[model samples]
Structures are given as structure tokens and as C-alpha cells.
Target: MTSAEPGAEPLALSGVLTAAEADDTARAIAGEQRADGAIPWFAGHHLDPWDHVEAAMALDTAGRHEQAAAAYDWLARHQNPDGSWYAAYAEGDATRPTDLGRESNFCAYPAVGVLHHYLATGDEAFRRRMWPVVHAAVEFTLGLQQEGGQLGWRRDPDGTPVTDALLTGSSSVYQSLRCALALADLAATPQPDWELALGRLGHAVRHHPERFLDKSRYSMDWYYPVLGGVLRGSAARARLAGGWDDFVIPDLGVRCVRTNPWVTGGESAELALALWTMGLERRAVEVLRSIGHLRAEGGLYWTGYVYADEAVWPAELTTWTAGSLLLAVAALTGDTATRAVFGGAGLPRGLEADCCA
Candidate 1:
């Protein structure tokens, strides 16, 4: 499949991606999956639980259902007894826990992928099979939430919780919690406690600036709340616009950080998804077009480009980067499951805090 020309016509809302490109990208991602089912950042690199799930979701988007299930099964097999996976595992080696810490966001993300897979396949058996995994992971994640509604980032190897909340990480967990609730609904189970946790987490994301660590320079912290469904409508639009000049490199893509000249495929693709979520299809198409420079010959994407140096940096083709692009394209093309997950359709709205009560 030939790559879409950058700055071509605005992508069609129903058929945004060419069939060939989607298939190639899916193949690229699949090639990176190990025999044990882990999709690492790249061959020989370490796999983080969060990025592994991201890649699996992309595989599901690309119509590779069985491969996606295998990815989840790897997570299930490796999950610690307390419902967490270590922060990182060595690529091609499931037995090696490269980082022993268990991150809240990473543990929670599998639910999002599991639910997305269920939506794509309508596999009741798969849904039932993954229910316990999702349940335990959500419980493990919520166990780390502080009173201020933001979740603690991770636990040390010795089981001590690190209580600082991260804006980007917590925003991700917020989305996962929503997906977890959706999964529970599908399974005929309800989680009132998680619903409350979702509400408070949203409140903290929207109103409690002090609750999270200050990482304003990073683009993810700026746009993740919107991408993760914590912010919506005009507020999300304003947030995107507020950082446009600082993070976006016109005709290049979104920068990894405000001060960096590096444009990352994953961040650029995520911003496109966020823009699409806000009904800015034209702008979203443009944002996605700008990232075309990152696509490699095999349909996998390079991690990032250093515009100042005029070279691709890191020199690695990451599974999650390609996955992010596929997911964004899926949303742009109006794929039903992609739309449902990102658009929060049929997902429960949590209770609002009653300040007066």
C-alpha cells in the first residue's frame, strides 16, 4: 500500500485510510510481536505494559483479532498476584522483569484494550475470559488513588507506593477506568466504587491543578486529559489551542516537549485523535498528515525526528508508534469500535461532585 500523500485532501470521515496502508501497518506491528505474545517497543527493546497494550489495540484496529488476543494473553500470564505487571519487561524474554516497579497507569491500560477487542470481535467468550483480569487490574490501580482524586504513579519493588500523581499518567488511568466500567457493564457486573473514582478523578483532572506533578513542558500532559476523555467540548479545544504554538511544528508534527525540536509519531498521532474527538476533523487530518515523515518503508514508524538535526533520532521502529497512527486513522475513518471507545459512546457518565451537599 502506498503511503498517503501529506497535505492531500482532507481524509474522508468514513474511509480515511487506504486499505493497503492499513494492512501494511498492521503487518508491521504483527511482525514485532514475539512468540510469547509480547509487543515490545521494538525488537530487542524493553516492553512497558502500557505501550504493549497500545500496540495490541492497534492490532485489533487493523483486523488482526487473534494476534491481539495473544498479546492480552501474555499480559494475563505475566500479571503479578496483586493484579499488576512490572513497569518493564525485556523484549523477547517474558521472564525478565527489567523494571520491577508496578505503575498504576500501566496496570489499568489492559482494560481499555480488552474492551476495544471485545467491541471489534463481539466475542462474548473473550470478554468473559478477560473479565477477571480487567477487574483485578482496575482494583489494583484504584488502590493507589489518593484522597485528592489523582492516582499515585507506581509502587516500588518492595511494595511501597510512590504517592505522587502524574498529569499524563493519571489522565490515562482515567480513560482506563471508564473502559473498565464499560467492561463491567458488558459482563453484567457493576462497579459503583469505580464510578465514584472516575468522577473524582475527572474532577481532579479538570479542576485540581495542584493534585498532579508539574510537567507542563511535556506535550502529553497538555493534551492527554482531552485524549483520555477527562476534558471535552470547548475546554478540550481551548487546551489544544492553548499549546498549539508551543508544541506543534507547522507541517512537521507535534513536539515531544515544548522546548524540543523533536516531533514524535506517537504524540502527533495522539493529538490527532484528540482533535478528532473534539470534532475538528479537518485539523485532525492536517495534524496526521504532518507526521507522514515518520513512516518507514515497512509501514512501521520511527520513534521521532529531530528537526534541528535534520535526522531521525533514536533510530528505532516502535510498535506503539505505528499503533497510535492506526488507532488515529481508525477513528478518522469512522471505524465503529474505534469511535465507540474514543467517543465514549454508551459509556456511563459518573456522578458529579455535590459541593453544596
Candidate 2:
């Protein structure tokens, strides 16, 4: 599907991207979107709830309002009775789930997307329609929150909880809970319990590394707390500084894993977002620009480049990589709605105390 006519003004990122290029990237993501609204990583790839929502939010940043709404509608239709979605669906087809596990972070992500759509379009009716969906999904996710405030990662197919928590996943959920609370406030249906949950979750993300599994080797684990808005000010700065040398490759973007030579577009874009969250605008722009080599001809991005091998390891382009890049650019360019979501100034910070203590 051709997303927009040729002559539209570009959402240019100064020297990094042009208007036409931005629209092409957004259209590329839209083109990969299935008839039922699910957006896989690529055509014929499995669709996961978390990345699906990310792609939808990117569409919103690009002013693809109708497509974004359709993505959310797809979620509403496919959500399990208990509010979670299967971790992966075959080729965006719900009937052919590739993974039966239900992940807490993945289940919680639609709240971010729904709220982003509402912020971008001022669609009160859409927000209202999605209210219950967000509510139920949050409830299902928080049901797995450990007593220490960190959230259990997922539930197996048998419905058994995987009690161990993941730093990256919990950090993402921190942002999602805040977004859900924001939605709750807007809908005039305040959730006091969510506020309390947010507090505990924040405490875990901010101070309790021992409670989460050790995945510091991955870039997401290193920076998600900041990107998710649970870490800020001096703490966020220190975290980024500590990991910079290990994960970042100066002009080539960020490595997906500390021990690997692969630089992924998604991780690089997200790190840019984390830097932007800490008010490092110039550095964020540089980081975004560093991955320019991954930009595919049609506006999508290759998944990752192996610098050691001097090759793009993943031949396929991914919607989430493009989505992440668009959101980062939108945030950096001062797009009001994107800034409101990622900038964390407008979103409510539920009681911020150590509820677990």
C-alpha cells in the first residue's frame, strides 16, 4: 500500500532524513501490516504483541491514524479472554500461534500504543472504546508482579507463571503502567490500585537489580530503565555512562549484545531515545545517524549489521526497526504527542514511593 501521495511535507530530522524518506518508511511499515491489522517483523514472520504495538505507534507518529486504529482493533479482537496475547502468532494469523506463552510486558504494551493514538489524534471515542482493553491487559500483567515489585516475565502454555523477572521487560512495563494510568485518568475512571502498582514497580526498576535476572549483556537491559522513564536525572545519566563503552560503537550505532559485534537498528534507536530522555539531544541525533547504513532503499531498515564481518547479517528489513527509528525521530523533533509519550513530562508518575518497602 502506498501510504501517502508524493508531495507531502516530510517529517524531516534535519540532516539525517528528508520528508519523502520518512513517509516512505512509514508506508513500508504499513505495507507489511496484514489485512487483519497485525504487523509482523517482516512479511511471513511471526507477530508478537510488543513489537506489533511499537509498529502501530510509529504509524501514529507518521500521522497514519486510521492504520494505527486498525492495529489496536486487531489487538482487541484477538486478546485472550484473560487479556493477554500469545507471545508469537504465525504470519500475523492468531489461529496459528508460534508461541503459546503469555508475556507480561507484551501484554502491557498496547496501553502505550492506545494512549499514544489518543494523544496523537485526540480521539476520545477511540480511547473510551479501548479503555476496557487496556484495563484488562494491565490487570492480567500485574497479576504476575512479584512481591518485591519486579514483574514475572511470562506464563507458560499451561498457565504456570515464570516467577523470575527480567530487567528489560519490567522496565518496559514501568512505562506501560504509567501510560495505562494516564489513560485511566483521561477516561475519568481512576485506578488507585494501578497507581500503587506503579510505585512498587518503579521501586523495583530503580533499586532492585538482584530481583531481576542478570541480562546485563544485552543492550536493552542496560538502557530500558531510562528509555521506559523509570530512571532519570543523575541515575539515568550514570547508567548510560556506565554502559556506553560496552554497548555503543561511537559512529556505528549500539551493539545488540555486549559481547557481540552486531549493531542493531532497533537497539540503536532505543538508545537514542534513552539519551533523549536524559536531555542529550545532540548525542541522540548522532546515535540515530550512526545507523544510516541500515536504512533500506524503500525506507525500512535492516535488522542489524555485523561490524566485525562488515556485513548486514539479517538480509530482511523489519517494521519494528523502522518504527523505533520513526518514534525516536518524532521524539527528537519535538512532536507534541511523541514527546508526551516518551518525554515523560506529561504522563502521570504514580506515587513514586517504595511500595515494596
Candidate 3:
């Protein structure tokens, strides 16, 4: 795969990962990619659309463009007739479905990956090739959006719509929608409905948390609106401050849930991304550094560490964990595309909704 420019600055975090270490981490993620380009949580683990795209974006962050493009090509080739992917796939044979559900966020995430790749490499052919895939996927996801603008989590295997929405999932969808619109602009095909949907979704995320499930105990719910670009300015700052003590443990990392004693690499890195979006660079770097314990010998990070039990839970090294950290580091190290995507500076804000209504 193509690499970054030889004279570029390294994605190194002081007192944490060096340039070599970062390269090793990227390679560790690439190693988990299947021959067909699917990246499972770990070797032999089930592949989920959301995590798969997350890992692919990381490859692009590390200048693994060819590998990342292959990953997107795999998604395009295997997409369902309805433009959505199954929730989980058998790692051994990704063409075989493991979980038959279709998550809206999972279906919508390819837009983010595609847009990131396009921004990173300026690949016009790649953008055109994936346009229809992204279009259909966004349509499938928006079909599940409730009247309040929050999207239902998923469709059952049998095509049943479960109308309950998730704050974190829909927040993620909000971010993906913005990315899709960015791609749409590049393709010269505007999606006005998507813009309206974006406004409603943003309102649901910012003003109507009651519309979503009470997942306040989860750290993602605490930070995803900020990370997902729906919440910002003083409101974003206030949200992070409110939840910092509950979720972040000093010298550890972010916990997956409020009551849990385990700190997960994925969530921690994602929090760093949120912090970086807020221009809190020092906090973001510190958050990234705190999770150094989860970095295993092979450069892949453990899924999480259970500080209460003094053990690494699940005994697994995940590509997404490393992927998330790489993305955060990429943003921190002045990767313009990564910064633009996560920072919400270049992406459209969509139509604004009347929150009072």
C-alpha cells in the first residue's frame, strides 16, 4: 500500500508512542485484515460493519491507502441488495452472515470512511465508485429515522424495524450523514432531504436526549455527541466536564460504562478525538498516554484492561483499538484530513432545526 511522504512529521506522542511504534501499530492492524480485505475485531473474531470501517479509516490515517481502498471495495462488493450490511459476519468467511440484524450506524459509517479516504488521497475515481454504495446506504439508514429525527438502531434479520434509537448510535449516524453530504458535494449531487434529516438528528442529539434510550452510564453516550460533531462550543465543553470524573480514571483510561472498573482502548481513544475536536490538545494527548498500558508487545492494543481484577479482559488484541488510537494520533499530529473530519470545520452543519419545537 502507499505510504505517507518520507519527509512528513511523525505521528508520535511524547512519552508514549514513537514513530516506529506508530508504524508497528498500523502494521499490526493491517496484519488482521483478511485476504478479502475485511478487518475483524481480531483474527478469527466476527466482523462488524462499524468496526470494519473504523479500522479501514485507520489504515488511511497511517497512509495505507491501497489497503484501505481494498477494505472499501470489499464492502461495496458484499453489500446487501437493500444497501445495508449484516450486523456481524463470520470472520472465517465474511460472506456468511453471523448476525442478521442491520444497524443504521453500521450502514451509514462507510460514508465517513470513504470521505476520509478521498480527503486523504484525493482519489476521484474512488469517490465516484463508492458514491452509489454510499447513497444507498444512507437511504437505508434514513428510512429508519423516527419523526423526531433520531434513527432507530437497526432492522431485525427478518426486516422488522426496531424503532428505539440510541444516543451514541444516532450521534454516530449524525456524523456519517455530514460526511455523506460532503461526499455528495464532491459528486455534485446534493441531498436536501439528508440535510433536513441532519438538522432533526442534531436537534435530537442536542435538545431531546429523552428521545433516545438512557445510555447515560456508557462513556460513548457521554462523549459521542461531541465526538460526532453534533455538540460543540460551551455545550460540548460542559458535557465533557460533567462526565469526566465519572468515566475517566487517572493513570488509566476511559471506562466503557460508568460503574465498570475496566478501561477500554477504543473508548479512550475516541474520547481523545472528542477532546481534540474541542481544541483541548493537552487533555487529548494525556488521555491517549494514559492508555499506554493496554499497548501489547505486538503493537496491537488489548481491547480493555480490568483494573479491578488486575487483568486484561477478553484476552484479545483488537484492530479497532489500535485503529482508534491511530486516528486520534493522526489528528493530533496535524493530519489535515483527520483534523477536518473530526473537527467538523470542513463538513457541513446541515439545516438547523428549531429545538423549541
lDDT of 3 by residue, 1-357 (tens): 535444445678796689999888988898899888899999988899999999998888878888899899999999999999999999925568999999999999999999999998899999999999999999999999999989999999989999999999999999999999999998999999999999999988889988999999999999999999999999999999999999999989999999999999999999999999999999999999999999999799999999999999989999999999999999988897788788878898889856435
* Candidate 2 ranges with C-alpha deviation above 4 Å: 1-9
Poorest lDDT segment (10 consecutive residues) of candidate 3:
1-10
Q: Cα RMSD to native, each candidate?
A: 4.2, 1.5, 1.4
- Please give the distance, in angstroms, between residue 149's alpha carbon in candidate 3 and its true position after superposition: 0.7
User: In candidate 1, residue 153 scores what lDDT?
Assistant: 98
Residue lDDT tens for model 2, 55-173? 99988888788889989999999999999999999999999999999999999999999999998888989999999999999999999999999999999999999999999999999
Number of colliding residue pairs in each model: 0, 1, 0
What lDDT score is found at residue 230 in candidate 3? 91
What is the overall TM-score of model 2 with all chains considered together?
Answer: 0.97
TM-score per candidate, chains pooled: 0.94, 0.97, 0.97
Model 2 per-residue lDDT at 241: 94
